[model samples]
Target: MSGIKLICGKELDRVFRDRKMIFSVFFLPVIIMVGIMSLVGNLSNNAQKDVEAHTSIVYIQNSPVGFPQFLKAADKDCKIYEMSDWEKATEMIKNGDADLLIKFPENFVDMVSGYKQGDVIPQIKTYYNPSEDYSRAAYDTISTGVLEAYRQSLLSQRVDNMEGLTVFTVNSDNPDMVIQDEEKAGGKILGMMLPYFVTILLFAGAMGIGTDMVAGEKERGTMASLLVSPIKRSSIVLGKVIALMIISGVSSVIYVGALVAFMPQMIGGADLGMNLTLNPKQIAMLAVLLVAIAFLYSAIIVLVSVFARTTKEASSYVMPVYMLILVLGMTTMFTTKTPGEWVYAVPIYNTSLALQGILTQEVTTMQYGITLGMTLVFGAVLIGVIGKAFESEKVMSI
Candidate 1:
């Protein structure tokens, strides 16, 4: 145990003493995260403002007597044009010269006013390019604002009471009607985004430092000297693994912290509702799960680093593993279906799933146990295998 601690301290000292390594691993990520995300948020806000300020060019065919007046009153930015030629209007809309085209049936007002129980109904048709943001916005504004208001006016003219039409309303402007865990709301949002990033970062952090630790040492012939020392092989493996885990864990924490701190500002200052009120148990579970992920990732990276003869070869070998981790992590983002409990036993994917579950406060004890136990068990087996590899005279001497 003392030997392991000594070697671990030495490994940590080597990294900490180097100022370049410290800045690159810890500080650069914060700068990048802030710079990139702030740019994206500003762009998004500017685009939204531009779209809202745009004047929509609208062509109305067979306009009702008060329809144009209603439209102009509702939307000051609507540029109303009366055009009877359908083909010209269609061409104008398709050419991006116009944002919307609306055609009302002849005698639309008369049809509504003189409607009987079994009469023909008048339908209004709208044409717009769905691909164009301005066109789509125009359509939505007209449909919900002008057309809906006009329809309501007609309904009032025909019926004595409009309230009879609504059978029931959900929530009905009552805030108390909605049942939600406000504390867990942010968890859902984080669950969707954080799991994938956490999985990727854990492995990426391990890969970045792990490759140069063991494989680089071998390439530089430091492994030969270390092998000749009085220290046991298991202590070397444990020491290196512990050091790698600590460095990668701290790196992952910094990265994730930057993301959380910068994300809200990057999204135009929108309220993320990330109210975290975690109890002691939840915090403990989260810590355990994160430790498990870091350990598992460190072991895998070290295993690959040990098998390879050079840092470049180790990097090449770790690429496929990184890709696999990426794919597994993304499953949390795209997958909506609830997975079976057995899924919790799977290594890379389960950690992501478990992290999501923990964040959302929906993970069962059984599921958490399965994921944590399997990950640690796998990590331990990998450490044992790496220890044996360290013992191989042919493997390390090369």
Candidate 2:
């Protein structure tokens, strides 16, 4: 026990005392999170602003005498193009030269007046590309203006002629929506992101310390000094794993903290902390899972680095592993539904799914148990593999 503590203290002091370590572990992740969020927020705001500022040009086919004025009054910035060739105007709208096209049937005004006088109402076609945001905006605005005019005309005639009288009035009561489990805007965003966020931070933390402890020591000819010490190899491995876990855990926590603080502000109308819910068991299980993830990643990194000749070689080997982790972490981002019961047993896949479920407040205790149990088993297996590597004298040769 004392030997393990001795190695743990030495490694911890070596890492925490270094200025480079402090900057990399602490400040760098914060900088990355802030920079990425700023860029996304700026780009989204700019795109929406551009869509809103664009003016729609309307191409009218066979418009009545006073119809153009009504169109202009509804959208003051609109420019009306009267095209006698209906096909040409439609082609213009399709080709993106015009934002909207309005076509009126023959005798548009007479038919409308006739309809108001108890004749069948004719259909007016409003055309715009639904895929284009600007076109959709134009369609909605123009349609609203036309529909409002039609409705007012109908009601005005009813009151003036006293022909139709309404006994019941429509009373709009904006009722509350009831849901089984409600997720806030912020919780949704955080749930999707937390898996990836923690994965990246854990990898970052592992990459530095794992390579330095194994490959760096090999490169510096310092592994011999540690190998000669009269201590159990398992204890040495344990101490290193524990120290790596601490460093990596700290890095990830820093990232999660920054994300939680900024997420609500970054995502409009989001209340992450205020509206979030997690059962005590779920929280405890999640914490356990995180610690287990740290251990698993650290053990794998150290095992790989232990075989490398130098820090550069260790980095080369870990790059693909990091990439794999990234690809796996992103699997839950778009999924609207949680994974099935059986999937929670898969290692990294389970972590992402558990996080998704937890954030959305949808996970069951059994699912958390499955994830936590599987994680412990995986970490234990890795510890055994790494312990054997430590015992083998040839492993230090690289």
TM-score (all chains, Cα) for each model = 0.92, 0.82
- Number of backbone collisions per candidate, in order? 0, 0
Whole-model Cα lDDT of every candidate shown, in order:
0.87, 0.78
Which stretch of 10 consecutive residues in model 2 shows the poorest summed lDDT? 265-274
lDDT of 2 at 105: 78
Q: What would the per-residue lDDT of candidate 1 be over residues 102-152, giving only the tens digit for each residue?
A: 889998888988888899999999889988888988988887677888888
The digit string of per-residue lDDT tens for model 2 on 229-317 reads: 99888888888888888888777777777877666545543223445656686577667778878888888788888889899999998
lDDT score, candidate 2, position 98: 85
TM-score of 2: 0.82
Model 1 weakest 10-residue run by lDDT? 269-278
**Which sections of candidate 2 miss by over 4 Å?**
69-77, 84-97, 110-132, 140-172, 177-186, 268-274, 277-283
Question: Residue 36: error of model 2 in Å?
Answer: 1.7
